[model samples]
Target: MTMRAALCIWILAAVICVGRGHAIVKHQAEQDTVVDSRANTASLVNAANKEFVFRLYRKLAAHADSQGKNIFYSPFSVSTALAALSVGARGETHQQLFSGLGYNNTLLTQENVNQAFQMLLDRANETTRGFINSGTAVFVDNKFKPQPEFLETLRQSYLADGFNVDFTKTTDSENTINEYVKEKTNGKIDKLVSNLDPSTVMYLISYIYFKGQWASPFDPVLTKEDMFNVDENTKIPVQMMNMEEELHSYYDQGINTTVLQLPFNNSYSMLLLLPDDMAVLENDISRGHVTKWLKWMRPRRYDVYVPKFSIKTSYSLNDVLTGMGMTDMFGDRADLSGIAEGQKLAVSEVVHQATLDVDEAGATAAAATGVGIMLMSYRHIPVLKFNRPFMVIITERNTENILFMGKILNPKME
Candidate 1:
């Protein structure tokens, strides 16, 4: 493996890893904050940014269906990493990256994007919420010196650091990168790179780790084996956790879907969407749909039951990204001169991995694992049971920034 060839892998993998997320941003500016106003450029920019995230999510979700597997990815991480990469990107490269990142505020320039993402990194770093540790790092061949502009932009925009490494020693290099990911994710992502080619010159990586508890705790004793209806004809036994909490929820009778908010330790919450039929799960996952769910919701109490499940998924986004109009960035036509001052570079691969563990404090696992929370019955209080497929989201209450999300066709499948 040539050091040159290895650098290609490093840049793509690291940047791609960054396009992922687990670190949740704190509460947004303010509730009274207009969704979009020219004077409120930050607010306007943020809302506009989510449009792209939701669009990307839909595409990735479809990919999950193609593989017949449960999946999750951190779009925030990916965006942050890409923002760092865009430091030296010019022309079409910058255009594609910005478009993919949902940066459409006409009033905001590319510099504004750097500032916004930097602000988010700072917010997560300072937040007291459940562990949200995020950072970016760039490792380069000692023989090559990165330009001041690239390094400074990366440091400011993504809170990134730089290091010199021996890419020729693929074993040590691979182990080092994997170790870094392991530590950053609290060991959730242990082996991101199994083998490193010797031709690498520089590699950059972005990572985030999150662990939060529910505001309401579930009763371990109440957890029991229940039938999870994957479909009309498929049923599997799963460890179903329960709690009786006086939580605010919205039950849409028209769609036979329920929206319940499960608060986390800090300012984060899990907005669960339980539908009556599995067929409707994909149709209702858009940002607009979630916004509507929140608007239509009023406080209600129910005997809530949810499955205790853990899912880990990985994806190769090279094709999807190319399909998303990032062709030049990955091909010879690429112009990544800003990074090295005068050198030409192109990305070769983009791999992303993620894990989701929904085990709260008190709820017991089917194989003896524990989870978390609420209310019930007179003549008969409403019972909200997730004894089937459901969708869940972990987000910051303040910003409504979604950190993680997934659809459970069958908890047992994971």
Candidate 2:
């Protein structure tokens, strides 16, 4: 049996800031000087983001709802949205956001984080090796006015655009926000907002759309139907894409996992990990393990089989973020004074949606986060068949930033 395969994923997150008030500023500098001064900051931010990625992933995996199910998300997208929100955060709210994002332990200050995000946003949106479109937008209620410093900060540091909407007209407001996200994600995310809160003074959204062709495209003719073991007793048919080539691979004896590195035409690559015991791998996996795996990988020729599959996941991250020490942002005690001076503002909702599709041509992904905020791989040669559950991590080669990460328990389950 043969199956058609195409890799395309979408992620969206939205944050709803509820309050009433108004505030406005502007500055510009020589582009050359700005870039030179922030040259080292991007890597620092990227490191912090990576640490948060695994921590968040472990949290997601531990959720009861995620048991025996496929997981997919864009950590970079979520971080970007929260980082943008942090601009308007004050006191404990800011500290919670900082610590929750794993930036507190680092040497980075808030300004450093902003500069790094600015650099990353610029690089991601550039028409370079692959198609990566990342952007942020704030939808403000016409009746509400944010602080001048807040808006200016978002615009300068996060590359965010501002729009005015009448929140009283919920449907219209939702459509406006959704349409912008849909267009940015190439229609990969069409319905990003629904049932807008009338009290909401602002809505912040962050989205990332990525489409990349594989460096070594798989021949469609070589794809054949095969069986995937979902568990001990369950098996499902899948379109297993096959290829035999010299590829970077590693076998970690400590955790009994096989790692494979699949490059994209751009400066990105997918790392796949198939483990003998998923529990052991999950418990032991960390940044150190990933660094070691990359360092230990060697080029080798092997027969590889990857299931062509697509999966979509939606998460309500309020509980997860709260569990991760981001409690103040969602409660009555929340202090977002920097956003608006006279009004009490708190985050009412956070939603994240992501989708992934993998095929012979390559992989394409889109993610959106709304505050209503919300917030790989591989292959084998040596008869490395992904016949069972495995992990997928897509990372940028130069920055070492993890663009997306998840686990595939069953390709047939979207």
Q: Residues 256-346, candidate 1, lDDT per residue (tens digit)?
A: 8888988765777778888776446565556666677666767776788888877666777777777677677886667677877556666
- TM-score: model 2 vs. ground truth: 0.86
State the C-alpha lDDT per candidate. Answer: 0.66, 0.76
- TM-score of each model, paired residue for residue: 0.85, 0.86
Give lDDT: candidate 2, residue 43: 78
Q: Which ten residues in a row have the lowest lDDT in candidate 2?
A: 15-24
Q: Model 2, stretches more than 4 Å misplaced?
A: 1-37, 126-130, 365-381
Question: What is the per-residue lDDT of model 2 for residues 150-205, given as tens digits with 9 covering 90 to 100?
Answer: 88888877777799998889899888988999887778778877656676778887
Q: Compare the candidates by lDDT and give the number of the best one.
A: 2
Q: Which candidate is the best by TM-score?
A: 2
Q: Residue 43: error of model 2 in Å?
A: 3.4
Report the Cα lDDT for candidate 2. 0.76
**Which runs in model 1 stand beyond 4 Å of their true positions?**
1-41, 253-256, 277-281, 362-379
